[model samples]
Target: MTDFLDPVLTFIADNPSLAGLICFLAAMGEALFLIGLFVPTTVVLVGAGTLVGLGKLELMPLLIWTTLGATAGDAVSYWIGWKFKDTIKNIWPLYKYRSMIESGEEFFKRHGGKSVFIGRFVPGVKSVVPGIAGMVGMNFTRFSVVNVTSAVAWSIAHIAPGVIAGSALHAISQISVRLALVLGALLFIVFLSVMLGRWLILIILPLFPNAHAAIARWFSRRPDRISQWIGHNFDPAHPRSTGMLASTIILLVSMPAFFWLIGEVAPNEPMVRADLAILNLFDSLRTPLGDKIMVFMTTLGDGVVVTAVAVAVALYLFAKKAWRRGIGFVIAIAGTAIFVPLLKLMLHRSRPMELYTGADAYSFPSGHATLNAVLFGICAVLIAHERSRWAKAAIFSVTVTYVIAIGFSRIYLGAHWMSDVLAGLLFGTAIVSAFAFVFGPIHNEKIGRLTVAGIVCAVLAGFGGWHVHRSFDAALVTYAPQVHKEILQAADWRQTTWRSLPAQRIGLNGDAEEPLVIQYAGSLSDFAGLVEKDGWVRPPKWSLSTAGGFVEGETPPDSLPILPRSQNGRQPALVLIRNDPKTAKGGRWVLRLWPSRFEIMEGGTLEPLYVGSVVHEDILRPMGEFSGPKTDRDLPDADNNPARLVPGAVVRQRPGGTPVVLARRPEQPGLASQTGN
Candidate 1:
């Protein structure tokens, strides 16, 4: 819940590799004897499983890494026991947990090598069984067979409970409260399985000695069969051979399925709505600083930047004669570039309406996201082989952060939707994975080339940054003049009140009605002066009472002022208001304005609204009006007391203080006699 976790969760959601790495590390620590004693890895591994079931992680990688980690740890324990023999019993920690170690030894003696398989199910025994097996001179081949099989089963058993819990929670969240009962039932089953398995083994099984012996014999007879099966199917060269095979199989299966899912949903209306909701959320968080940061981050994924960096790195590799790596890099970048746009064209999904500043391309499978994954992800993969463990971790972390930041920038800047970014990441990762697998052994030892490449890339990156800034600035202006034109036309009475007064429920009788909406045709500063001169006062709080008072109504009004803006959550509405200048002198009106138009609301009627085209504000400028659709009520924050605005000047409040002032019209010369008030 800390601010720190937001980026961590976001990174986990965006990158599958990191999630797998975390699972592997947690499992390894959990299975290692000495470390397992100190590390409480259950919660960490279960949390990883929960992430998987919640759709934040891919299940295949999670299973592969966890199984591999657990298996490797067991192998190490077996080696330590074989080397140390009974001498390990004299170790300080072994002396402390003598009873548990003796129990493991007794169990191994009774069950022979089969104890390795059965012990994995028992918590305390699981930590000691592999060592006991090795200490008793069990064959390394036999120990490895049971170690791997049990590790797989153990990883699945422990992680599955969390997976089930997460899946049930996710399903219930999507469907209804009825499904919550199903979720509860699943959790109960997990609890029962954990407790019941132990009870049956440690208590009930002992009561029936014959049956227990029969089961032990059954496991004993299977070691040869299990070894033969493993020999026939699995290569023993790599420690992760089994997991690698599983990952490959899953990747092959998952890619087509994911592509099919994308094809099915890309054109749907619900998908558009989902994209809009996410875009709106990001839009609502747009502060001046955030906008600049996102814009800068977005440059990392820019087509120009990606191309320049890729080419520079590739050239450096070529100069160093690392042909395979250079070729893989090119293919990765080229493949992403080709496939992302191809998929976009095939889907033909239009970008969300909020993406108003220029990118008019099909929005599915974002080009920026795909390219970032290829560019940054390939760098991580290529460097991983040569770096130390700590260095690899740093490289991977930075890569994930860059990739995620670029993907996020796309969504934040309204260039792509959430799904588009997700799809792009998947596609890009697939490309990188394939490239790495094909050319993994290629090494670049030429430090000179690397240095030259880094310098070239640094310069190109600077140029890319400049290009992105100018491009984005140009894009904002591209739509500005046209948007301003539309606002002016919409604000004019001829197009607004003149044609739609009845629709707006203005006048009842068939009477000659004047076009009340005005095209203000002036700068914001000029409009501010006009409002002040016309006996209007801008109030700090925008409320129904103040708005209703403008039209002689009550707090819970019959009608409400319509402010058009994107509301993120329950933030306070920024309000400006003034008393009615004509027809109802005592009545107050809500003055709502955006970059396009300004409106005066008297009892929610279009009471002489104005629109202007002459003023050209920056697209990123924070207009007081809501940025998106109109809300039902533009309410004030309950916690924030109103601050009084000084007449004829902008209100300035000390850091945290309260001052209240009501709106009042300043006297004009002979105004009382002129207006007959």
Candidate 2:
């Protein structure tokens, strides 16, 4: 593929809401700052980021939204610290993770707000850093300075890779069918990993809630063992270094390396979701700018994008004197960027398009999703330092919106399968969360606060966007007599809209005086069949009459896709309301009048049977008598222009009954249910 962004940019233009959401979610994955880059939301976030290249949506709007969200998320975390301070460790998840909190506290005391900056990367400290900063009562100016600076730099840092990838997707989309399968296999692997993660959470997480904690406990049990192991297996300083260099090395080196390995073995699924039908739909929209946008997005995606972002973030942190934090951001960014591509080349999996056409390659770890995920998650952790409630809420909301927006952009852009984005998000979140745990606050208070926060977040869902598709035309006829299933089994559902009789009659003996009016007002497509062959019409004396017409008026003509005109008798059709007369077979007629009507039994409903066809079919030959008004005074100009009548004109049949009138059926419910006619 020449570029990754080709599809991503197009998707952003078409699905702005989705773009906003992915960015928001990625930010929420963590608010700890650059350290948050460890979260897996890169796929989701970068996908949304790619939208910027499309040039349709302005970056300012999204930037404001995401920055605020990150700010808000971290702000709350900080408030929780200010409110309960050192006591928050008693909460459910936190209580179980007391050591992490203690680790954050001790780290904070020596490093001050710098720990908050550095804590953005340390898994345990990422979440607790803000809370710890708040507990220690750091100066508001210093905290905000660090918070906003980190938040802005972090967002760009995380989203850069995603935008790069989107730009490249264009060239990938141009390849032959052979490569498509390979891409598809890669997407499949990404999907598999996501499902595995989900299953792990659903099945294994609850069962082993303390896996990380247990490991910590295990290590605690044998301090000497941990030290010896650290010396043997990793940097000797990890267990004893003042910077926790030994633990850091083990975390940075071991687990991430394993994840990279997992990514290598994964397969791909190409074309992922951009189908020919969808491409055709857009092509028909006739906008040349469409392809242009895709091309721009895909080309921007490259490894250098990640590297540059990391370097920038490191520089910023160092400038701010948050040396440790600068180090963490550098480590996390460098690690993810290096590992993802290595795994891709190692696995050599094709994109979904490679396997099948238009698929992506080496997608086990979605880059876009991971980028935003890690950045946002880290930001959330850091935002916890903000003390203002409104401020925190606003930023938190915005961060989540961006994360979710970017996630959607990936799918809409057709750059990643649904699973790749989700798995990437989850994986990113896990990593950032690990950092948050190690460097976050130690809450040892009651569980009430955590419960309240959960409830509050859920309440926000109610106010979010709510939408659904609406389609009328209630029941579609899949089988009609006009194009009977005999020849084309698939030609059953015919769409029609006619205003005439539904049935017709032909008798040798009966006088034309009455015309044996069986029904009128709908259309004639079903006349010779249901009434003729189906059992609705009797054999001896009476028969039916019918014809056809058109429909009109709507909010907008193009609002609804036009139902195609009939060719070879297969077209869109409709049923007009009409009437029946002269004791027809429907529900055993009572002492009838000139026109007819019946109550037929369907399920438990004794519905009034006016003029309607059993099936939809094209109305042709507009020759037969028209279905009209019931009263003589309302008689339409039937003699002169009976084929097409005006609205509200009276239509009378010969003698007394109007041209269209009902012959009421007998009242017996049992007879209504049994009428074979």
Candidate 3:
């Protein structure tokens, strides 16, 4: 994965001009009427923004090209609409999509000229609004003005999120590359899951009538007792027949999966091995930022939040006189609540980490996962009961995303094993399906489906927010990474134990790269002071402002930010760089120090030990401009010599013959200092 991504990023960095061209094409395709419907413009523009944040692409040119392309596409669409006018309704492909045009016309009539601007952000409406405006004889001047302004806003809207995400990933990579990769994977999985749900619904929705007809026919051919019962309840003529059939299908699938999970989890079988592997992966990837995010996500599935939503939904249903639905909702929620605890007790399984005591410590089926699935699943069914196919698809997609996020958060936070969450989801799904099968297809109800949805969302946001705010700090402490300290005498570390530490720097993919040429046992402040006298200075941290240097022409070697490098999934604690006069265009000697697990007990203080690698970096110019700094793999022999930099530092040689510098701070009377290593 590292090998693949590194080359792709390098290619983008080498060809800055190609970035603008790709953005322009993506924006143009996304703005085109029919083509826009199929184009994945959001993903493309967002990817371009990520490159910008990663210092591979310049933001300004891409933004300009994207704006231009969007405006041009809209203008072309408007011209076609103006030229054809009402005749467009009879124009081959346009005639087949008349319904879309009608929808766009209605939106334009309702919002008038503002529709051109507003529709740019609305998915379906955005594709046809410009054409609708032109067909209705809107002035060209007004259309162009609105078109340009909205295009700019749309470009920013699409790109800003990716920029923020890329910046965050880059920062996290500076802490731990593995953690950053895990976070990126999570985001991608969530996105793919939601998209696949919507796509599946679109593909299957049109075939429902045929499937129903076939099933009805088959049941009529067989006069058995079971077939008779199914045919009677799931008759096509019945109002709730579709809901019942869907629930029955879900039951057929989920029940078996739920039982299978129980068998796998109870015996600590092959699935348990996978569970432990996933847990260990997450354990190694734990970061403070990731912990906070997972905590907030898990809090959304808290009993308080789920119960509040359940109560609100029940009240809405009953108040609207939908007695069957109200009863069914209560039954489903109650079933999940009762079964989760009972199953946990029956299995008596321990959690990956003990976040709570007593019954909470037992983890067989995750309560949070089960309860949230039941809550969201029931809500989706009720709200989508009488909606159009598109509406149903949207609801299902959102529900699936929420459920998956909450379930994954449990595994990521070590609150539950993967099997536990899987069991919870399957069991909760079964319960919801049973409820739907029993009480679905209400008739003559006075309920407003949209109102019910709004109420549920409001209660969740209100209660979930309050709960997270109150418990976040305590949750952080509970989820903090556990670090163990290993102490050694200063003499032992200098003499023999130094050999025990890693001799080479490990890359993000666990491949050995640079040699660990320096070991310092002292306060970082003292080490910094010593290095500063030798002409080494700290480079500015990477940020939006500093990133501008990449696109700027002829950035000085010393002024260029040193891109962070990770060793064994850990970033350096301290970084310093100094100019290399040997190169005419300019080069730099970069030093990165990472705190080792070993601590030296010297002069009654546990002094931190740091392992470091010094490598030379040369300026990279792409398209006749300074792009960024690239590390030179070949090391300069003189650069690794530490005697001239740190006085009294001992020079030792590893078996491989590479020199290692060991330095320590001078001892002070009656003073003891400790630092994390």
Candidate 4:
């Protein structure tokens, strides 16, 4: 595909002015007599749409070129028919396929100008219908009028879907995975609706006669007000107009109300708390296996994956002659792409801080959650309509489960709050429901070629999964510097080094335990002052129940709780504490800092005492267990509590370290003076 498209794409990319001509020629070929039957322009038009999205071609020019080309193609066929008249059927291919020409003539006679309009949407019939009109000596003015209108609609129907698909792909790739999921879901919903709508139209068409008779018989039996009301309101003859009016009313009223509600409550503290609680609960339950599963499920909701599905579905619908549904699918997706970003900009809500990699966008109305509800929900609706009872029920169940899982994945990954997901579900569902009302209640036949869909989806997911992994990995690597800066700023401290306490001298009682000691080059007052900076507030066990002190910017706090007075005081001691609910990691620290001493507990702050008051010999130890021996007096067990130090490279060891001592009284005045100096 690339080999075939590269030259064309390059020509257009280099000489953008010729894009119109190329599009015109391509669409003309797709619509021209005889040539239209063989040339598959759907792929070409879709490719051009993608190029337009990539900014290689201008959108308006492309649309115009395609429309004009299609109109011209039909005009040429009409002229051929006019000139040849009744003898045109004697031409080789025409004579060979005289039945098709005869049928077109009959169809034209039956539907009149509307056949010309509807024929533009069907593949083989489109080229033949125009010629049949001319052969029948249809009014030239009327033929031109129908020809131009259908051609324009036809052009948009083909080209716009491609453009929309390409544009959606581009937009999602530029943002985070979470956002991509949201957009993907909306696209999925639109595609499903279009597919379903096509099938529904078919099903409804055949049933219309039966329905009318049944209704008449039932009405005779009733002869009542209810029957009259039903007939008056739901009369199928004008249901499309009724549907449009009702859909319009619902969309106008409900969409604004939904947005308004989101706007009103998004900034509320309670909402924030709810988000935190749900996220924390999920995060606590997360395991490596679950994470892997969530990652794959989330990948399915990616923009690229979803876009591929939409394009594939659109092509299938077009192939099946489901024009209205195909066009609606494209419109629905395009609208979703436009709306999501606008909402995010308006709300500007921040993301939770517990994410593996920092997010760069606002959080309210999570894109992933919205996508899950809209896209997967639509898939369920579509599948439920045509499949057998058990299959439909099973497919519907899985789709719902998948949607829930995707939403949960976002929260578990700390990409969004629960409220954000909730709002997303609401927004996405409303959009889908509104669109369904306008162009749907899709009752499409069961679409075959599941193998094709599966292959496309698998390829998309593989690529999207790789893209997401690369993006996330890169984000995580660059996150540390920002984290360090944020942490320092929050604690109200600049970078400083300290002389390490000598491990042997600080009452280790001959114990061989060596704990990682952080070397800070500052006074006790300076450390306390940094802690008092409000952003590093003490955890609830030591203070208020409501968590606070830090806010999410671009990184999460590494603070944990530890008791200063006792081994089990419940107060977070000697650690940098971020008490904010948004940034909390739901764990305690193993290390602690004090005025003249540092402590390393056995297992986090809650564990038994491991090593305490090890005034380092001006070198911060690099490693220690959370729980172990209290004193250095015990013999080192080879397999058990081995002592290690923080790598000297990290702390930047001095060439010849300064001799620092920790003693209440000195044996000699000279030694004491030297230590002080």
Q: Please give the CA lDDT of all the candidate structures.
A: 0.54, 0.41, 0.78, 0.52
Best by TM-score: 3
TM-score of each: 0.41, 0.32, 0.58, 0.35
Clashes (candidate 3): 0
- Where does candidate 3 stray beyond 4 Å? 1-14, 28-38, 50-56, 67-157, 160-187, 207-273, 308-321, 346-348, 356-359, 383-405, 433-440, 448-474, 483-677
lDDT of 3 by residue, 146-200 (tens): 9999999999998888888888888887887666776787777777776655434
Candidate 4 CA-lDDT value:
0.52
Give a tens-digit lDDT track for model 4, residues 1-677: 12222344555666655667877887788666555655556656776877787566788878888889888888888888888988877886556456557767887888887898998886446768888877778788988998899888988888787778767756754643334333444445444544443333322333344455466456546668887655544454544433433344546765676666585554434445445444533443344444554566565666666676667666776777667766776776667766666777777777765332323277777777775566555544444443443464455455555666677666656667667776776677676666656454444533543543464456556665676676654433322111111112201211121233333212111222333233332333344454354444443332111112122222122321232322111112344443224312222122333222232221122111122222111111224212211122222221111111111112222234322222111121232112122
Summing lDDT over every window of 10 consecutive residues in candidate 3, give the lowest-scoring window: 668-677
Better of 2 and 3 by TM-score: 3
Off by over 4 Å in 1: 1-236, 239-257, 267-270, 353-360, 386-390, 441-460, 468-472, 475-677
Per-candidate alpha-carbon RMSD to the true structure: 20.4, 23.3, 9.9, 24.6
lDDT: worst 10-residue window of model 4: 640-649
Query: In terms of TM-score, which candidate is stronger, 1 or 4?
Result: 1
